[model samples]
Target: MLGRLFLKLEFKKVDYAELYLWLGSLMKNNCKQRRQFLVMAAGLLAASVVPAWAAGVSGEVKALEGVAWRNDQPLKLGDPIMLGDHLRTGADSKLVVRLGGDVYLLRANGSLQLENKGLVLGSLRLLSGALLAVFAKSNKQIITPTVTAGIRGTGLYVEASEQSTYFCLCYGEVELMPMHQRSQQFRFKANHHKAHTLDAKGGVEKSPLRNHNDDELAILEALAGRKPHALVG
Candidate 1:
């Protein structure tokens, strides 16, 4: 009877040991599952925060020769950018821009200021020199020294000089408005050119001009230190 009691006690101890081991294993598995769940939750939270941080214009900016300044510093290609900003290109430096399916080839010796107020399409103020603007579906405007070209979905070329400003439409129509006198406006058709001659009183000559190769010729003349031939003489 004594031997049987001792054996029964040993068996009870063995069962308790097994139960304790099983409990330990279950606790370890639970802890691992909880850790995995926490990791997955953190990954999802990071993914949700990315798109809200990227609502502005971002693109590559390349300078051919001189420096290109953004926010008063030099700009680099493939760097992220925003609007309502001023950029100054170094002397004899060209700027190449790519943003939202639009490409702008900016000639050397120029400055551009962008104004994007969300509702209104962005506006560009060209301080000087020439720029070839190619637009997508959106309308683009170029505010020159003496004229403003309201471009409708097309490619256009603009050149500025001390005496006047020139606009040559290659693909679409551009409404030219003299800034000095807001009432005087003209529509320049595709394959047509117009010149806004500046006078003492900020007045412009309203004349229809002709220049077939003015777009190509302006680039050449700008490089050669000569004023391009005026189409609307």
Candidate 2:
């Protein structure tokens, strides 16, 4: 009954460390059999709760490298990156942010402006530099100066500049369309990596994956409480 009750809890919102400490205090007052039951319940609770909690948390700074900024202020670990925030990274810096079931890694010299629907981010604009992202099944889009990508539960890497956008569908599917000619659109499905270059004149050219890799995708996905679908079995 105790294990069942714990399983029914919305544990994502609970502080697990404090919960464990409280359980420890209670166990000290119980007999051996009750203590054993509590230990068992704790194990079950942890296994069920962690993934849910990680997937449900939004606006969390999961990792930061070198120096980064959020809304023009110096960024720190564990900072809450709210929806509609303006984010930037310094030269040689990187930033990782978790938004509900998705994770994004912004590369050096990147500038991003987030767009939100209520409290959740539905889309984002990469003003300059590069970004790598993974998403859970949702209606999400990424916009750049030269192109826009509508993604559905996919892994993507993009670099944006004034003239062109380098886009790589790391895995899964994406609909890529040029900003200048929205009528020129194409869907790409990749099991590994499929690369393209979108020019300002609305030309799509096939390219090679240059800077990102599977290992980096795995790392970001793990932080979002999942594994790359290719690595899962």
Candidate 3:
């Protein structure tokens, strides 16, 4: 009877050990499943957050001495910008601005009024002085300017003075019309430049001229707020 009782006790111990091992395996599998579920949930959350951060204007503006206005507030470098602000450069002051995706170089005593929200849109009014516009290929808009020249998907040099507006196409096509007569359109190709003069009856006269490298120099000067010869090589 004693031997039988001892054998029974050993059998019970063996059964308990097997049961404990089985429970341990089940717990480990459950923990692994929970870990994998948490990892997938974190990945999904990160994917949803990426697009929310990339939908605003990403550009810069440098003021030599004047002030730029955006959303009825003064604009500065590293400041977030919105649409419908007037950018005015004071006399002898220069501005380098990037809107949407285009780079604009405004020379001394120049002003550009923004019309749309993106990098390029609506109308830009060149009150005076010069502006060089370099547009990205993805931008497609009819940039109309009063007393200035317009370029589409290309780089061009625009200079406005008291006399008239001069436009030289450095790399792409340009459209010109008198500020008063928006109906008439004139297209100028690359390697060509033209000047438009307004007459008494709101008529426009065009004169062709030789292209010069002065436009690039003017752009560099405007961006650096000094003479081009001093900065450019």
Please give the CA lDDT of all the candidate structures.
0.53, 0.76, 0.49
* TM-score of candidate 2 versus the correct structure, residues matched by position: 0.76
lDDT of 2 by residue, 50-123 (tens): 44245454577767778899899999877888789999999988788877778898989999999997767878
The CA root-mean-square deviation of candidate 2, after full C-alpha superposition on the true structure, stands at 11.0
Clash pairs for candidate 2: none
Model 3 lDDT on a 0 to 1 scale: 0.49
Top candidate (lDDT): 2
Q: Each candidate's root-mean-square deviation in Å?
A: 26.4, 11.0, 25.6
For residue 3, model 3's alpha carbon misses the true position, in angstroms, by 95
Runs of candidate 2 with Cα error greater than 4 angstroms are 1-57
The candidate 3 region of ten consecutive residues with least summed lDDT is: 44-53
**What are the models' TM-scores?**
0.58, 0.76, 0.53
lDDT of 1 by residue, 1-233 (tens): 32442353334422222222232344445655433323332333223222211436454452234567777878765455566667667776666654554556667777777777584447778877777665655677888777777876565666666557766666557787777777877776654444445442356555444332333333222222223222223
Error of 3 at 212 (Å): 8.5
lDDT of 2: 0.76
Residue 63 of model 3, lDDT score: 30
